[model samples]
Target: MAEEAGARREEAPEETIEDDDGYVEYVPVKKRRLLEQQKLLQRKGQNSSLVEDGRGAAESKPSLLVKASQLKKDQPEISATEQLVRQEKDMIDRLSERKTLMSVRELAKGITYTNPMQTDWRPPSHVRHMSEAECDEIRKQWHILVEGEEIPPPIKNFKDMRFPDPILRKLKEKSITRPTPIQVQGLPVILSGRDMIGIAFTGSGKTLVFVLPLIMLALQEEQSSSLGGGEGPFGLVVCPSRELARQTFDVVQEFTNVLREKNYPELRSMLCIGGIDMRSQLEVVKKGVHIVVATPGRLKDMLAKKKMNLDRCKYLTLDEADRLIDLGFEEDIREVFDHFKAQRQTLLFSATMPKKIQNFAKSALVKPVVVNVGRAGAANLDVIQEVEYVKQEAKIVYLLECLQKTPPPVLIFCENKSDVDDIHEYLLVKGVGAVAIHGGKDQEEREYAIASFKQGKKDVLVATDIASKGLDFPDIQHVINYDMPAEIENYVHRIGRTGRCGKTGIATSFINKNQSETILLDLKHLLKEARQRIPPVLATLDDPMDNVEEVARASGVKGCAYCGGLGHRIGECPKLEHQKSQAIAGTRRDYFGSGGYGGEI
Candidate 1:
């Protein structure tokens, strides 16, 4: 029975043991081995879970690193873009400021006095005013023949003149008629030992104005042997440019030919300019000459080298006085003037007078007469003025168009040397005949270019303001300002190149939006002072003529008491019919006709 019970228990599924209520437990025969197996299974499961968790953590860490790196890289790009945007804004602001300053400068250009005809104006109290009757009486007196009223006819035989016999003979040979107006007016004053100021337009016989006086002085010095037996120069004529000095010397030489023929010849002159041999000039100075016509820079050098002496200079003339100052030669001019004896007779001749020039005269001139023959501080009336508003980029294109429209032999003025060459090259590329002259070129090149231009080898001469004044290019049909001058007075000089010797011509200025308001104002004032009608397109909102009706209402336009004309004031109206009739008939016939009609009988 015991064996049967044990078998049953063993067979009872190796019966599970109950540790707690209703719980079953199993036991293995190799107890150590079983426990080891169970422990190994549990450790394997736990290791699996740990490995999965570690993989997730590693993957998350890599993603986080990538995101942080991306953020770091993006930060700099954003900052750089911001910096670039700020820089662009700053540049824009600077450009705006420059534009504003330029605008103000243009507005202040050339303002002058208003015309009396256009407005009710009065002369300064110090100035004398004359009535119509008084002016008419003076005109009549000018025509009357008083004792010795007639200029004695020039001596048929030049030998009878007081000049050296040879010079007189030469004058007779050349058939030089009477002295030109400038020569007549300027020579006597200079010879009388008085400081003089000559105001004449270009080619209005101006060369003769100073040249004749210089020649006479030279002649007197030669006759009296006042040169101290050496070639020490007796007179010094300073011009602004080398080309101008050469031109003046050439004219003087021509005049000297006549003097030479009359036996008062042997006049010697030296030319000192740049792009020439300084040693050769020094040699000439050492040899001594009666006259020296030079430019400022070269003259200054020669003076420094002791190659020229001005302490004994008896005559000093500043030709083209306005140009000398305009070119920034004021200091050089002052230095030259200082070198001369204070007692020397100085002549300052200019086409226009500005405040700077007036101040210069006050400092340099000694109580001189201001001889303004034609319109003062204005362009020559004979020059037909025209202006075209164009874009800066299109200037070259427009210049070419203008050249095609106008006749050849045009003088075009630029503001810069590079512009001269640039336009010159552009014209050449367009198969146009053109030449350029500027400060950058050598003296010989300039001379050759000018000569070519003068000889008609080139149809157009492209030059800077350097060629604006003191240049005599006869037969120039037009003067085109490719670049308007910075100053209004420069415009006057530039236009003066045309309308020379009473020959009418055209002056065209190209105006751009960038042009200064000062320049425009000055141009307007200049036109007004010259009695010219300003073009409506150029008229600004402030122009009196723009609101003529308004201005007329404010001023109360009235008819003249003399002629009942709307354009004239009560006291002022030209008697056109009477003046026209009197002008048509010679003065003698007009006087007789007016007086002989219905005699006292």
Candidate 2:
């Protein structure tokens, strides 16, 4: 093959164009390179078939070279799709560099400032607030106590606080005249920029205690920053369930809307929860939000997906802190704090404070001002608790009876999803206007059900523990516990649905020996404190020897058997002695066989 290629190269005519200082050349540039390629191909045995014919070899060599050039032209090149992807990646890198900010977690850890308790702080003269003595008297009267540090003096009215003018106006427009005991005490602590743990009953206006602070902080930050903050949330409110998150979001939106109307930048908020299309939430978040209210699960999922960022959040509120720990959000909450390294104001609010909540507070809050209203785990004092011993199978019968007697706008609580559905079905079948909400229902269904109940479209809202905490449904006439909660604290929240905002309401629990034995003692105590009637069956659970008179008083039972009078027992009754004397004289006359003046034959 090599000898044939050499013969073909020698046979081919060589032509060259000489330079100006010309010298003879054997081949032109194009033909010289082509002949060298053919010889190299022949030596490698690639053109061995053409080696058989000298004439065919010269003719096919040009064809083979043309084919090789075509092959090179047809080779794959970088595609538009790939090039566009590369460009997008480069753009993202540039954007990340420009958007870089301080890490919140690192800032939080690096903060070394300590908040010392104020021993001699006084109420400002400009504010129409209570004096230290007045505040202390009010706190003592309401059983409000601080575990660590004393908070600021309570505001006598909403106007006394140094809030933005618009916010203050909104407060009055809403007719929020006087603060509740918890609000009176908690608001001052939060507005003072201290980490706080608020322990109050379910309907003590705990929402506003943290929400007011959140709004104030956002307003101040915007006033300070010319460009405002980033797309991420500046305040993060984490609740245990989607419903509570949405409820909190509604409250935030209501007050923040005032900011927007006053020609301030809109204080945007995003609601993140499961059972909804996440893409919609992501789009809202991408457009930017100032506040984010979310459930722990959905919030954790968003953090993992990088759909939202909380590194810039300066305020963190855990609503229903105890419930969050019970719902298994401890790890998720820790993951959240990992992103919030910046020194932030932490607020923990719960109706009940178990040891778990205390531990969580110690870990999360920085020298928190603990404001506890009333005893922890105690239900609202305003609610009248009624316990009835109804068997599980007879619950429906007793429920119907109670509903017949009670007024409209009743809230029935069940322990689980299946019970919620069953009660809803039973109520509907009985021709009652009713709706159900539970974890099993979709987000839209649950929300619509709650809205309908709140709007009076449905008289009865059958629910599981979902509606037990932090949902403000106004004018709930009765809270019927169709099934006792496994957790005693939940009972407080369940009955708390009614008797909100200092309004009187009834909570009727269908207790049996099976499900309620664990919480019977606490239930009895709660009933006694509320001055409510205790059923005879539940009253028997306590020993008769212990506080018999007190038990009779709580049960509304008069110890007098003769006349059932409240002040005196039968032995101390004046009417009882007269009746006994008359009976004895009649008996003596009959036994003496009418020996006196009466002619008895």
Candidate 3:
């Protein structure tokens, strides 16, 4: 019976098996019965042997087999279900892992890395850099205008104007053959004792416009003095900078020289500036000088010290009025205005008339006549303006190229004193003769630099805006803007350095991508006012990728093969290889090292 039960448990369907409440039981099956019958027949021979032995062993074995089979069959469904659940869980885990990886990859695509120490990063391009060819073209064009174009004939009908013999002789000696438009228009009002505002370009001969009338008035006053000595500041000409004051004083002295030559008494002129001794100026003041040429600050200082009095000043001239207002001199100018009596004649001259200056004029000048000449501080129609886009790093490179290609005797204007020094040093290293001038320089140093530049001892002058107005260097053939001026009028002053006295000259401005749009707009407006034809390329919008690297690649030039160490080629280099090598190895070691190690170690 046990054997039958064991066979039935092994063959039975797994789902029908169960545990008993009181006793374990197995249901009989037809297959199990057949198996039992066969086993019985096969064991018939062994049965007789088993009968002799105990049946206990066989029965025990069958019971054990039945129990083991029942246990395994009971657990089969649970084991299979657990395996299926584990497989499903594993599949979900793998899918989640795959999604995580995709997310990480997507995040990585948008990220970037930056290294602050990397020198390879490109700088924004500067707007003041220009190409050599472009600079030359501009120079050529301006020279043509300066030489070929006839300035509009001076306004006629001033022959009957009354003036002192000394003043007339000086005017005739300087070939004041005909009066300029400003002179023609402004002289009448100035002579009529009416205040006026004169707007003109730098080289439009505006200085003479007021100077001529002031001198005539001073002479008339001197002649009328019964005591043979004029008193109480007969004429006062105030300028923005000490250099401008000195310049005006020099011009006025020229007129005085002509006066003395004609047997007229010397016109006493006092120069009041910061660097010169104030005591000396006070001494001149005590002696009662007829005319005073001074800067605003020094003039104010003198007035405050009570060392000088302007209570009776009849004629007052403010040159570079626009610059004064721009430089925050409004308060100082107003204070100076307060010192003068209301009946005084005030003449205001500026290259441009911005709103601030116009407002200042309204308060300063009484019913002033406004005279605008040569487009009113625009690029002198005589001056040719050309701009080149270049990388700031390559600015020096382009400047050297321009200097090489064009003529010498150039004036280079920088934005600051440090820039002037840097450019001056750079030019010297390149074997280019140059000098630098700035406010930091002492009067003697400044005077020497200007003298050197004017005397042709230096081929290039790198200077701050201090050298912009009134300071004239006659032979300057080119003006290269190492940096753009802050104001449009400053640009006019800088370019005005060249192309003076009816001589054609060139002004080369460097423009880079990083330049301020406000400055560019001002430049555009200035160009339009001058009636210059704008280049189509400059008129177009700049590219976003207009960076320093692109500009450098466009403007950079490899060292000339012929010149070796020099910027020019070997054939063009004035020095031989041995001399060039020695110079580069010794005097220019720092410059070459800055570029990178150049010589063989």
Q: Which is the leading candidate under lDDT?
A: 2
Q: How far off is residue 245 in model 1, in Å?
A: 1.3
Instruction: Estimate every model's Cα lDDT from 0 to 1.
Output: 0.64, 0.74, 0.65
TM-score of 3: 0.62
What shift in Å separates residue 374 of candidate 3 from its native position after superposition?
3.9
Q: What tens digits encode model 2's per-residue C-alpha lDDT throughout 24-93? A: 5565678778989988987657456656755446654456889999998998886554544454334334
All candidates: CA RMSD in angstroms? 28.3, 30.1, 28.8
lDDT of 1 by residue, 265-335 (tens): 47778888888988777766655688889999999887777667776677788888767855667667766
Question: What's the TM-score of each model vs. the native?
Answer: 0.62, 0.69, 0.62
Over 468-576, each residue of candidate 3 has an lDDT whose tens digit, in order, gives: 9866776777888888875566788889877776777888888776666545655665665566665564567442222222322332322222111111222233323
**Runs in model 1 lying further than 4 Å from the true structure:** 1-184, 226-230, 531-533, 544-601
Give, for candidate 3, the lowest lDDT window spanning 10 residues: 144-153
Best-first order by lDDT:
2, 3, 1
Q: Tell me the TM-score of model 2.
A: 0.69
Candidate 2 CA-lDDT value: 0.74
